[model samples]
Target: MHDAISYLLFLVGTFLAAGVVKGVTGMGLPTVAMGLLGTVMPPASAAAILVIPSFVTNVWQLFYGPSVAQLIRRFWPMMLGIILGTVGGAALLVRVDPVWSGCWLGVALMAYAGYALIAPAFSVPAALERRLSPLVGLITGVVTGATGVFVMPAVPYLGSLNMSREELVQALGLSFTTSTIALAAGLFAHGAFQVSQLGTSAMAIVPALIGMWAGQYVRMRISPKRFRQCFLFFLIALGLELASRPLL
Candidate 1:
């Protein structure tokens, strides 16, 4: 009984911390949550618990920006690719070993963190946006489906578009929303999402929202640049830890 209570408390605290990161940076809920929870549970289970909260939070972000219609119109192809790729990739999730999945996730996290730290200045050419968007979406979807972490080629692809900060945030929201829904569908298809898990996922929303609120308050006070550096460093460490688990 005590162990159960402790686990529940850990989950609440995890979501709260993840929420604060998302509230401040407009992302990181799943990455942070999965990183921490994967230590306690299977990777697939961690991903399962993230479904509802990730969707709700990204939905909030999706509507908070201007020109939703325009954004949708521009990114529909990528969205479609995301759905297809996720469905395909998620089919593998149920069959893969948990340790392997954790290693894959860890590698992905490290790669993502490394890329972010390098901070390349390249942008997608206007001419190539039409050609490259679907590919990016497909890749991102596959990664998300396989690892339950969605922020690879997609985030970089979106950043390459050179949208204004507000537009970029909204675009991320849209991408994340699409990823969350597709992830949920994949999990359902694999029979990984049980009713009991759904209840836990739903309850997590409260703490996530609370953390978001607190994070928003902190965002007003801190330097985003500095915060991001710290966040990425943490991810790098977490990624290393996750990657080493298979060997351990």
Candidate 2:
């Protein structure tokens, strides 16, 4: 963050771009925001600024297409694992170098982009869900805690669950919402999250929402697959940029 005005402009632009990605693809807000912001700021500061908007948006998405109770009943272990893993791994941010954090963050972004672009065909047996979900959640949470991006193995794991599209979407909402809460808690535990970040983080909501609205409109009229491919490719580029920072 440089001058106040420039910071706000950049914040708004970054989040607006993130919102559009999420609107079109049903995910990617944190991934895109963290990737871009991590380039210029430490992971902890970026994570702090990200907490509110990510929570607000994902919470909204969480309630829309399913029974929350059923989701919790089925996914509680995994959710619990996320909380535990995030709590356990949060110290990485306080202890590790920011350059290492950014490099890992970029790798996480690239991992997700490659997976989503390829859209691998795989499925978990229903019987195995009970055994595997928590493991996936824990890995996701550790990544979330370490890098401030939480999609990786979790999103791909979710897709592998063979859930119906509606359930899948809402489940992702729940997963993201849970990750956001845990990330906030992790930041709070270190006192890295502060009230000073709140105003700008909250102000970011308007642009994010506006961009989402616009993206929804674009989603209807265009080839979403094509748009998504472009977005994924862009993420790969961003990933490369961030990953190169330590070297640069």
TM-score of each: 0.98, 0.97
Candidate 2's residue-wise lDDT over 86-109, tens digit each? 876778975789998889888888
Model 1: per-residue lDDT, tens digit, 13-92?
Answer: 99999999998888999989988888788788999999999999999999996768999999999998898888788866
lDDT of candidate 2 at residue 15, scale 0 to 100? 93
Find the candidate with the highest lDDT and give its number. 1
Scored against the true structure, residue 175 in model 1 reaches a CA lDDT of 94
Backbone clashes (count) for model 2? 0
Deviating ranges (above 4 Å) for candidate 2: none
Clashing pairs in 2: none
Clashing pairs in 1: none
